[model samples]
Target: IVLDRSGSMAFAHDEVAKNGSPAAAPPGWKMGHAVPKDARWLDTVAAVNGFLDIMDDSSHDERVSLSTYSDKSKADVKLTSDYTEIRAAMNTHSRKFKGGATNIGSGILAGGKTLGDKELARSWASRVLIVMSDGIHNTGTEPVPAAQQVANEQIMIFTVTFSDEANIQEMEKVAVSGGGQHFHAKDSQQLAEAFRKIAKSLPTLITF
Candidate 1:
């Protein structure tokens, strides 16, 4: 899964006190970036963990990798069948990287590389890039070209707009360009449901 960890993603419902804005944050925290106090970020992480848990329960023989991006892309979890390891890699976001900008194109490139790893490409029957984002891009290269490049290599990409404020049209275009589907989640519950549905490749966006 490719997740966005940009500044825009770190917004609290009840603002706390971050860089003049009321938002809770770690000690000595600076402005221009998000801290752990973001409700939306918490929701995204919870939904992702839930997704991993569901995958573990299914016990499907699948190798999954994780990529997170904000001004740059980091492949935290290389392709592995161990869901627990993936979860651990995800949890390290407590010490998140500098994310004043959203480099979605970098995320796509990194994920595509992970899937296209020669050793993996030979064994894996399918490759899919699932990118979840809650904000529009502010920095980094335009996302479409990189997305197109990844798509050309046959890595289908599913773009998830994590909130109503998300750029649905851009994500939809990304999905179309990458030969995958687009999904929108208005709340935490819907986000969880979307993840579950994606796991099963179901047609509907809702689970219940």
Candidate 2:
């Protein structure tokens, strides 16, 4: 899976302050006032943890990987089946750094490389890339070409757009180019539901 860790995510409507203290909603903001006191980042972390908790482990031969994109992209882990380690890494670093531009193209390319590695390619029945972002492309190469490259390699790419600033048109293009699906989430609840749907549909390419 791929996550967008840009600065915008810091204000993802659900993220609370970096410190443990409650986040204050803007004055007169009735809607956001009802949001949880914690930072949206923490909420995202919890959502990811929840999704991981219920993931099907019956397929012993399956492998999964994670990558995040920001000013600089990094593959936290290569394709592996070590859910314990993956879960630990997610809990530890999911809310680490919060700055820079969104280098989505590089992230997708890197994810493709990790997925295309000889061992994973030969063993898994399917290879999938789930990209969650809340903003438009501001860094790295254009997202469409990178998405096309992934598609050419026969890797499925799923996208979740979580902010009004997100370029819906571009995201849609990328999804179509990659032969994947595009999803939009306006709030934390919607985002959580979108993730749930993606998790439940993990074993197949078709959306639920």
Tens digits of lDDT, candidate 2, 79-135: 777667667665555434444578888888878888888865664357678777777
- Write down the lDDT of every candidate, Cα atoms only: 0.75, 0.69
Q: In candidate 2, which residue ranges exceed 4 Å CA deviation?
A: 14-37, 57-60, 206-208
lDDT score for residue 127 of model 1: 77
Please give the lDDT score for candidate 1.
0.75
Question: Largest TM-score belongs to which candidate?
Answer: 1
Write out the backbone clash pairs for model 1.
15-22, 16-22, 16-23, 17-22, 17-23
Provide the clash count, candidate 2. 7
Cα distance off (Å), candidate 2, residue 207: 10
lDDT of 1 by residue, 1-208 (tens): 9998776566653343133432556666654444556556677888888877776766456678998898888998888887787777766664553545778888889988998877655553577888898878667767788889998887788889876667789889888888888889887888888887787773232221
